[model samples]
Target: MTLTCIAVDDEPLALGLVSAFIEKTPFLKLVGRYSSAVEALQGLLTQTVDVIFLDIQMPDLTGLELARVLERSNRGAHTTRIIFTTAFDQFALDGFRVDALDYLLKPFNYEEFLRAASKARQYFELVHRPEPAPFVISPAPPQPVEAADDYLFLKAEYQLVRVAHQDILYIEGLKDYVKVYRQSDPAKPLLSLTSLKVLEEKLPPKRFMRVHRSFIVALDQIDAVTRNSVQIGATTIPVSDQYKDAFGQFISRWL
Candidate 1:
């Protein structure tokens, strides 16, 4: 799972360094970078980020102050993790007081940055990991002489769209939205304001499987299944550890 993150620092060099480091890290997707805490705070209000690489010392709104505000704004379970980056080591205690995950002493190497990032990644993975749904077998119901209607009506672009179940190649999950990709026109995807979990329940379990946290692929649309990924058309989706066991059982049937 990729973690969406933003960097906030008053110094140009510090901001650029964190931005570059985030770019280099595969799991970290840079959503936005700012040179001031005010701008970063505004961006946070608009975007759903998983982590923040913030510099503790800034004019007007220090990272500590911003963290306090964020703590108040986003209380309870879905709070964003913070990693303070500062030249002074004295602020380390203050960083922990605000529940910062990790801190980086400026002029640190890439390895050190990666270690801190890894800690944040582990924390998120533990907290936000998907639990495996209980699988059970039920007695088959009486068959209908005529096949039941196999289509879903989804609301998109202010219109109710009828989509055939078999036409879907895969579904990608954005923060609060899901993009349904169809085999008919791979170029266009129908965007709906729904969660992946909701679609997972709507789709026939026999036809689709959740291979990754962000992806649910059509079993018949899968052209290949590698040791770590599944190929549908030109796209290769990773099979995360959380769903690997279920996928393995599915593959065992035909293997």
Candidate 2:
């Protein structure tokens, strides 16, 4: 079966790259392609796309910014799986806030693309299958994953990094990925992860909160709030329309 997909990028060369990559995959059907997020948004309004190859930085609206707007609309349409294709590695943790399918770095090889495609296929299969009876990956025999409740160990290139639930600033969901931010350095800090939803389920909700689609700042960690931004330490996170009301209520109830 052909998977209907859309490719959006501001750069002409990047657009050509996506076109070339799609040509190699027989199962992928290029339903549409756009040079700007505005054009892609128009396309999505009328047609149904199974997947979207989105670029983060654009002239007017970025890939991340557009997704936030669409989700806020909450239209009655089939949800499109987002796949973020970008060169910015630092935003990996923030991408997770939007429940992305995967994060593909720029100038990706076919093998890497295939890996992401394979994962996407497996995801759809798992989605179709009935929910499993709580899975566990401990030293012991078949047991539910208990570590999920405690804390998630984020790997930041060097070694195994452990982050407590209270340390999270917020998660940002990219096209097909997510990013995680925790309490750390200002100019340089710790971050790791490629999926937001993946980490959200692992966090303890009593302390963690999804304040924005691109952010899940720790309630107690927030130092100030502007009209459209939340200040957590030195970080200024955007609160998109999709998460405004929910995040507002979350803060209102606590304060």
Candidate 3:
């Protein structure tokens, strides 16, 4: 959980203060401190650090230029996150353009520095955490429950995806696999190796219906229904002739 970091500042006092602050923080480990970006570049080549506390303005080489070079060098692996430290407010936007973790304005106290460091720690934790393996639990004797479970887990892309049943908009069968579209994120669908027929049997009959050989629609997610199709968001899912009669009967009860 510890993050190795380095401080780069042209001013001796600023560099010393940042080095001290990094030492004070238990999670932060100071590996090096440089008076210029050029001097820091040499150190970076020999070592791998998780975070970089960079000063915006420095003689010989600017922080923005150094960040760009680091980004190119570490395209897919061992990427370093930069946190720009500067006195001027104008460089804040530029720091973000270089994908800096945080901007610490000049005269920032230890509290503000700690907040920025905490953000960097959280980001690394989320991105670097390993995907959990799927597991199965043994069934126990049924007991009275207060409410129905709202979520189910499905294995996808070698990871278990916890899908909220209420968020599902529809399920589209693709041969032996199915694509689950949900309300929370319409752009991406979860793909898994499970038959549409099996899914249909598992889902609650009151909330979902098989409208076509390859499509199952969530009753509550249907925005509009026509003679031949149902609308959910931008997708127009077809209601085949075989199920039209049952769909019509269901609609009749509602209208």
lDDT for position 5 in model 2: 81
Model 1 per-residue lDDT tens digits across residues 167-201: 99999999877899998989999987678999899
In the predicted model 1, the residue pairs found to clash are none
> In candidate 3, where is summed lDDT lowest over 10 consecutive residues?
152-161
Ranking according to lDDT, highest score first: 3, 1, 2
Using TM-score, give the best candidate's number. 3
Which model is ahead, 1 or 3, in terms of TM-score? Answer: 3
How many residue-pair clashes does candidate 2 contain? Answer: 26
Could you tell me which 10 consecutive residues in candidate 2 have the lowest summed lDDT? 153-162
Q: Model 1, residue 210: displacement in angstroms?
A: 47
lDDT of 2 by residue, 1-255 (tens): 567788899999998888678768887888888999999999998888777888889989988888788667776645667778898977655555555677888989888876766555555554465765855467767755445555666645322356676666667777554566656643444555446666667777777767666567677788887657788777788888877776777667757
- Per-model CA lDDT versus the true structure: 0.86, 0.72, 0.86
Candidate 3 off by > 4 Å = 135-255
* Model 1 segments more than 4 A misplaced: 75-77, 132-255
